[model samples]
Target: MDIIEQAAKRLEELRRAGVEVAPEPQPSVGETARKVGAGSTAPADAQGVAQSRRVELDMNVLTAHGILTPDSVRSQLGDEMRVIKRPLLHNVSGKGAAPVKDANLIMVTSALPGEGKTFMAANLAISIAMELDHTVLLVDADVARPSLPEVFGFDEERGLLDVLTDPTLDLSQVLLRTNIEKLSVLPAGTPHPRATELLASEAMNHLLADMAQRYHDRIIIFDSPPLLVTTEARALAMHMGQVVLVVKAESTTHAEVRNAIAAIESCPVKMAVLNKTTGHVDGHGYGYGYGYGYGYAAKSSASAART
Candidate 1:
């Protein structure tokens, strides 16, 4: 099937899901400033600030796993990510075409589990950090089934949920500063059964505004759950500037992908990635990998039929 047609099918799913793609006015700056600008670290000897801890990530382990090789390494993975992130960086810096609202906020998800969305999200954040002017904030948004702890070799730590649940909590308290200098992580904290509801709450919106505004130089990447398997991702998508749906090459049925895209139709910008293919394209052995196209075409008029 033509990959553009596959992307067309993905857009159709959003229509069926009753998602709106129209743009809304951006939130006022004052409404968002309070939640942002805490920086990567907390202040020392602040009053009543006894509970603050920093988490460290293992770069050597990640390198061994191929999740992170040096940016200068001449490899398919490095080159591919470079292509994948161009439009994203454009969206972030507003240097390409038009500026995207909340452009700094990005979510990586798939049609279902075991599709490497988490892997993609992690690596994407690290890859973005490789840039000279950008920093990365990786959030494990899959609260119910988070994988950041394992992916980054960090233990259970306080994170996004802790602040949402407790009004007394400050975001600076939970934000983790990694040894990577440019990369920081916000893990899914203590699981909550009402993860979906929490993500959709008013508090979440305000927090997202703050996150979007804070660290104007930072790109936020959320590793979300499979669209068809979890409600949490749908809620999280509302706060994001861009959505990247990872479709496992031959393994993911067209119907599955269509459904996944439909779930997040309301998102203003969405991209589809065809993952894990075996081929020798672009003069290299690009095996079992992915390449995506921005839903560069109109999103609302997309159409497709199930076989």
Candidate 2:
């Protein structure tokens, strides 16, 4: 089947599965031709034009995965995320304890794999996008192993690496605007043999600077690789003003946490998120908890108790 047919089939499947799929907006003929010429080969149909410019995020899938959606009901996860994002937002708005350069650029990472860093990243992005004044760009920077496609259910497309490697490519061409108003996503893009080198390259620095200044009200969240497992996360951290480290409760060792914090020591603001906690908070089972610290102070105060 062609692109439009495939999209129709997918929407049908989502509908069959009881997902409330929103009707896609139709773009003008001129707009469709512009997108088609830009790189998208989708047919000149409403669905095709919509698919080229926007993606319909499945609310049911988000809920099933324990992610906070725009229409998500009030719950412990929502409450916890609010608390976790408050300080980060403060820094972004220049209201924190200290002024943070490029405070809008935030990276979410972990010391090791399987620590729920990606999960935290997605939730944080979604939470931030719900804000009234700020918009969010969720970039999948884990080049070697991107998971945002799976998390958001959007097909993999050209993104961060592609822009850095190809001088001809523009960030606007690869950015996928989602149905969620205020949220857009940049996929990991075509993987390269020198992904690590590309992320640290001067080209990457230029792209980051452009992204940081492109929209004054925009916050860019990078779901980066594990700091201890790969060099990419550390390289990305060098450009990020704030970093959120995900620490699995009762699983991630204190030594590992310390090392992870040390890896991103160059970041102006560092925060720790205690994930997968087993306990009841406010009469609800806890899935996430957080601790805020900056610099070496996090190393001393960051601790998780066994349930």
Candidate 3:
């Protein structure tokens, strides 16, 4: 059976077993768009269907927050992100050391809060979106404490959870297309009590499959919760082909990093980004930089580091 059919069957089984699915809504496209704060001037793609609502991201605000913008001049942060995204893009193109099942589905998380996972996720998405051959969808998967709306200066609307809960909600309806042609943002939707369950459900699997296969050059970055702080991140990590763990240099404890890595052990490709590392550059004054290590090399380095 196809993915959609398999997902439908599994959802039916769950419903029969007493799972609480959201009641189907019969709202028209316009009503649905208005309800989600998606404006009326929805652009149409090649298929002639209305595309996602277009939202303008403030360039000045993004610059102030150190976010990578399409038109921004090159900087240390952009250079770091380019280095960090190389292997990831290689994996996505099936050019890595080994093939990954859903290399396009990448989750960014940390061992603890305030470790810069969201920042990393955003930068990575922007960097990939700037790629000549790629498009990116940045999903705010941190349902408990989402930051994408604030970071991007966009209003919160129905998104990932909404699509998962309401079968009637199409992913395209809730997606927020940004001024940057290649970048799109998916809000964390209305918070739900059973968010962990929703993320781990069969519906999520199907949605991810659709998202990964929708465009060959599309890369989806999920800003997930801290692995050690919430069960939600672990649930989301289970299906991610690559897990990017952001570690705060001189802040996160060794044991915490170890435990966090263990939580997402099932992920095929695990990468660690050492954030906020202060060091000298070319005899220049000390400045912050990002350090990158891939797969087991990163894990081993983290294990050997002293807290």
**Lowest lDDT 10-mer window, candidate 2?**
292-301
RMSD of 1: 13.5
In angstroms, how far off is 257's CA in candidate 3? 0.9
> Which prediction has more favorable lDDT, 1 or 2?
2
- Residue-by-residue lDDT tens digits, candidate 2, 1-307: 4646645654554454344445778799999899667965543444333232578898776665656789877865677777888899999999988899999999999999887888788888999899888899999999898888877877888888776654444577678899888999999998777777677665566578778886557899999999998987888899898999989767899999999998998998898887765654235344443222111111111222211
Descending-lDDT candidate ranking: 3, 2, 1
Which one wins on TM-score? 3
lDDT of 2 at 208: 80
Report every candidate's CA lDDT. 0.70, 0.76, 0.77
Q: In candidate 2, which residue ranges exceed 4 Å CA deviation?
A: 1-52, 280-307
Candidates ranked by TM-score? 3, 2, 1
Total clashing pairs in model 2: 0
Which stretches in model 3 have alpha-carbon errors above 4 Å?
1-22, 25-50, 280-307
Question: Per-residue lDDT tens digits of candidate 3, residues 64-119?
Answer: 55677888777667766777898888899999988988899999999998877777
> What TM-score against the true fold does each predicted structure earn?
0.75, 0.76, 0.81
